[model samples]
Target chain A: MSSKKQASSQLRVGDNPLVKWLLVGLTLFLTAILLVVPLIAIFQQAFVEGAAHYFNSLLEADTLHAIGLTLLVAALTVPVNLVFGVMLAWSVTRFEFPGRKLLMTLMDIPFAVSPVVAGLLYLLLYGNNGWIGAWLYEQDIQLMFAWPGIVMVTVFVTCPFVARELIPLMQQQGREDEEAAVILGASGWQLFRRVTLPNIKWALIYGVILTNARAVGEFGAVSVVSGNIRGETNTLPLHVQLQYEDYQAAAAFASASLLAFIALLTLLFKAFIEWRQERQEATL
Target chain B: MSILIEHISKTFGQFQALSPLSLDIQEGEMIGLLGPSGSGKTTLLRIIAGLEGADTGRIQFGDRDVTNLHVRDRRVGFVFQNYALFRHMTVADNVAFGLDVLPRKERPSPSEIKKRVMHLLDMVQLAHLANRFPSQLSGGQKQRIALARALATQPEVLLLDEPFGALDAKVRKELRRWLRGLHEELGFTSVFVTHDQEEALELSDRVVVMSNGYIEQVDKPGDLYASPNSRFVFDFLGNANVFEGKADQGKWLNQQASLQLPKGIEQQDGQLYVRSHEFFVSDAPTEQANLPLKVVAINPIGAEVRLELSPIGWQSKDIWEIDLPHKAFDQHGYEKGQTVFVTPKAGYFFADDLAQPTPLHW
Candidate 1:
């Protein structure tokens, strides 16, 4: 009877015993080597010497400065992306216009283009020798090769996260609730805060988490514009690279562990939000 | 309040959703905008609610001109098809939203808002559900809560977009009756949009039937059903059968079937339309008409026996339907594939050039 049941179940797609085992084995092997090992390796190496050593390396002045600068960049980047993302999603989903489809395509440019290319584009426009940069240089406002440069490139690279997360959700939830609120005498702000925001809270937070994760860990773009100036232009990722190049392997891994920790935290929060959202939908 | 809409029109880029049209809704009147999909009935209702702007028009609520007013400032209570209740808020908060959103000076006190919400909930007979989320309620319960929420601010005009569309049939009928009672008790001017002929006929004091972004007819439900102005309205009302024939010498002719036109209904190139209920089946041809049709199917259920018939000696692209009282059906004992004669007791005749159909009776 059990064998018959198994045969019946195998009638479904991709349920053959050998094929399933092969696929599962391949997936497990690849995940263990490609993802699990590297993640564990970072933490393992960070504390290889001792917890005291790890703390000392992370608490170094340059490392501390790099940490603060990374947090600051994320702080500036997340809010800008959040506002821009909500507006873009709202416009494309709620209203119709000639360029609406084109605008949605344009929003995905940040995701499509290489982060280094994005940084280079910003540098060319805002660097010292470029057209706009020459004018800014005369006014003594430097954007590239400084902390501001890091923030700008990070913003450009992470801009699509919030909007990407929000677009499909807002499209699904639709403009009806907002319309209802407006017809019930809700002002513009009231409509958003009361009707629109509550429906999208989880998605918006998920977007923020993605944006923050990308902003803090962004390397290719930040490298192009940051100039790798230790204690000044250096972010944590840059500092980790510099430390690795200087042959301070343990210290580098210690700093890498911080980014890894944040990534883990982001994953945990994302899972929780997804679970909560599922519960919410089940109740509905 | 009476709503006076003048020359309202809207065009969405290449597609014109609404052409230049107007409607006058009397004070305390419940009007229904009824049409098929994409017929601009919802668009007309949205424009009236100020959820959408009209291209060229003036909207006057009572004596107040509100053509350019924003929806938030219009003070009109609007309910959406899916209830659109705040999912994050409890039913009480959803009901109190309108009162809470009023500008500071005019805003009711927190305690007053609570009392009014409870009172509204009580009126809808869902006061026990005040603490529950909208998700917890059934479709009918949610609909009642939505109505109570809409009434919380005591607006003079209420607009509902396909109010009971998503409910089951029994719930829809119940909600329809409940809404009618509420509308009468409140005495608020109301306009609702629906594609349902039955709902519009049962609930509205006057129904505005639309087709292809234009108003087809506007009249009391009884009058509208009895005399649909155009062919579109006739088809939209459902269960209508048409016989395309030419009229000559006071006789409508198609093949061997001939139906004599009533007095003053003689016209060239007319199409006769008959509702299923308006036609009668007899074992022999009547003096007024001779439409020999073979019974394709007989549905003996409900209050009547419905016959699906195909013509025996006439040409109709579609099959014809006739309904008989069960007693009559039992007496005749009609069966499938049996030849029977059908006479349209009452029908409307639409000519090739005329927009309005002529009512015909034998």
Candidate 2:
């Protein structure tokens, strides 16, 4: 016991300069090999054929169509998720009801399941030979191997983002302020619009950013559901895969670089938001 | 307007929060619900504010039944213990919230709202900090803003649940005086809940003493203190010394002490309750003396000295606390371990013991 106490007392930062330097060196070495090297390689490969060739490759009809389709899919998915997230979070946090824990667990199911499994689940429910698919086919409505299928898979993969961001925040805020508003003669909708919405706006924006990023970058689920149809169902990530398969290395790297750029932009935006939130909270 | 509560009772699952209770407040009266924690004071206050519905009750605001009305329509301003001010809004905006959230047809224009908010801020002495957020204000300032916001709608009745319970000692005293003054000038009927006996007695026109989900007594502060109706009220309202003894004929006797009972008292197990200041200590034993006690501890509070006394050679659980004024303490020169005979100047007795009482004063 005395020896343990002595060891704990001696365990201060910078106690062993050599060990600290070794750990720092190891961390940098691993980060360079794992992250920095691959990022540099992707940019290098994309620009190998020159900037003109790279820009031309991206301006191709099928690639432009894919980019437009990805944007369309994100546009449809992110808003739906945003609305659903706010409603679910509000209901779960503000009210007492039976099966609340079960509802929260169900909301988290998509996050726990593999993306490929999520895609396959949707496929089994909406594929041509599937139950719903056959009925829709009789009505001349095509859902499988189409843009709708791609959008559905993307929504499933990104559905939990906004609600996950908001549930804890609304719960922490509690019902006191809203109750105070109600007692102050604010109507139901007015309480929500004036009091609740402003409080959760930051978390809502953060959730939307995450959901949009996931919807734009989703590959596994969209591939399984979209059936890899070039220019029609292929999103940006799928287009990159198709370009690589055709042995067009320059085209593939150019498309991949676009995704990398988006991801980087998302990181920067998230960091800026987090910094702003921290400053606001400090004043609070 | 006066408020009336009739047969109000509440139960959460199997726990009985409040038994059948009724209270009436005259117009412009400042009443306090005084009790310890879980005594249903807050629950009763919330029911009055229309925030929580009583299981079986009818509430009326000057004969207009408000039992079924929503909180917004109740027009009763409520100040919570935590202040509940909107953190994102400035003090002026928070005060203006009630006016801003009114229905479009009833809503005031923006400039009118600013003027009314500024006026209320000035009333609360927060006009200088109107631009500051609640997070930037001290606890007292935040509570003042809460009070200003609650009053912005000109509520007929105001309800506060431990309004000063969250503040420190000095701030609480100052705000208590300020609130009393505000209520007098505004002429709004208000009910506040608090566990601090001093706060309740100091600020209230009348106090409702409650215990175990039941109303013990309701009276003016001086009356409640001088003549408590139950053993619970006697103990809860002030410092008390309890002595357990058996009533035999016209005398109450126990293993360590005996006292002359009031005339014609029944023979039964009884407990005598004496307020700390109601006892006198004498150096010489007299006929009125009940027991010789050794002073175990002496605590000199601000204006009075509290003496903890135990009967000499007594192994029973009874220990008497005698409070003497500083002048009396100086004259008697009582010290720790000094022996003195104790006699009750005034006391009350419950013939059925402390648990369930049958009051017989002596």
Candidate 3:
């Protein structure tokens, strides 16, 4: 009986090596074709004109403004979304109430809908002759083709990032630590700042990073809202499109490479953060 | 301080988590709420800690009516089963959390907070690890830090919900003893929830045995052990050899065995529960020997030998286990497949409170 048990319990190697190798080969092949190829092509095209030309294109006044506008939009959108996301996640995950599922589904709307649809939805709400837009326009507030419009669309596109990252994590963490803090004489805000915030900080950062990336790189939505006004409301992705349309191929790829670099950095940071978290958990 | 819970009750949707129950915990008393998982022990603890509000109840902490107070305002310290320490905070910061969160006017100075935190860490014997985050601490160390944090605010009452439930057996035993010592030193009114009857009995000034959202009994360990009020308490507190039989005119008889009842005992159908150690075994069947049993298995566990027996005219269902001292076993020369007559040394008979026979499955 013991020998049979030991025999069954012994760790078995791959039962079918062919299937294992096939799976590995297929994954690597698909990854190379889909992800690696596009990444390499962007850099290849950007530097096809010498490094000096690529740098000169990057330093162009319009390109600089587009980069600045993208950064400003991301800077503004990320913080707003970060606050809203934390509040949304906290309310949904920590409290039990009627219509919580409905609220959660609403939060996920930005993720489910196309960015173009999201921009259109905001436009309907705030465009000239639109619902709230008509009243706002009568009050002399320009929103449809301006910076605020760009920001509004960015916010809508990135709304679910932080909350989506945090909700499941906070839910899994449960209410014990918060309850303990409360019992230990922590006020509501103190409980949140001390206990809840620290627990969800890493997830919050991960969410913010993704949200910032999306806000900077958002194309379809920002395009629908911004009117593609150069040096004014054109974000980096829209700027890339404008350059491409104007036959400024070197400039477009150079700009594209910048966004791609940001995406790569975000991916690397995310991987590092996850690795660190895993290491910490392993030590624990 | 003493806590008065008046007719406390709670329900989660259709499930009643706590029935209308009242308990008075005196100042400096360490009370154990002992029960199975669904028995509302943890719920009651949470209610007292003001972490959960009772649907209908008035709670008084000393002279103050704290039933309507927020958990923070109630000045109750709570320790959770999972240790619930702030994962990102070091041991010192965790211990200082309660004090640091106090309103600015009431908050201690930074140096004062540091001193107090270190003092608490020293008390828990974790001062050496004060810089370590909760994740770096062992389960036992984390729990001790939790206790220290809960105590930092000088709460009027301390409540723990299965505080050591996440720990291994050896660590649990060590922490239970440590908690007992700490409770004695601090002299705070405390109530802890635990399902382990031995833990409750060993560590509590008094144990409140609960079942199905009702308090079954409350007594000192010795008293509760000797005099369990209900069948649930009797079964939950310790192991028992339960015999179901009908008493008739100073004698009791079941399908497979007969025993003489003590004189003047009422004639009634009931179950008799005897602790294993309360049964005597002998080689010969005398008048005092009530049941003739055939020993089927002898399990030696430390100083005692547990004899698994079947009645002489055994049906498949008729089996009894009795524990004898190893010396007694040796003296009697008892072995498997040998005949021995057994009699109850001490036991309890509950009228009409028969234990349901456990079905045997192969």
Top candidate (lDDT): 1
DockQ of each: 0.80, 0.77, 0.77
Give a tens-digit lDDT track for model 1, residues B274-333. Answer: 999897778899998899999999998689889999988889988888888999888989
lDDT of 2 by residue, A63-116 (tens): 999999999999999999999999999999987899999999999988899999
What is the lDDT for A186 in model 2?
91
Chain B only, TM-score of each candidate: 0.95, 0.93, 0.91
TM-score of 1: 0.95
For residues B1-362, write the lDDT of model 3, one tens digit per residue. 99999999999999999999999989999999999999999889888877888999899999899999888788888888898888888889889988988899999999999999999989999999998888888889888999999999887688988988899999999999999998988899999999998899999999999988999898999989877877898889866877777777666787657777776566777777778888767776657445778889989998888899887763334367888888988887877898888888678877884443212111
Top candidate (DockQ): 1
Worst 10 residues of 1 chain B by lDDT: B261-270
Q: Which residue pairs collide in model 3, if any?
A: none
Candidate 2 CAPRI classification by DockQ: medium
Off by over 4 Å in 1: A1-13, B248-250, B261-268, B284-288
Candidates, ranked, DockQ: 1, 3, 2
Report the error of model 1 at residue B4, Å: 1.1
Write one digit per residue (lDDT tens) for candidate 1, span A1-284: 99999888758876688998999999999999999999999999999999999999999999999999999999999999999989988889998889998998998898899998988998899999988999999999999999888988898899889989999999988888888888888889998898999899999999999999999999999999999889999999999999999999999999999999999999999999999999989998
Query: Of the pair 1 and 2, which is ahead by DockQ?
Result: 1
lDDT of 3 by residue, A38-154 (tens): 999999999999899999999999999999999999999999999999999989988899999999999888889998998888888999978999999999998988989999988
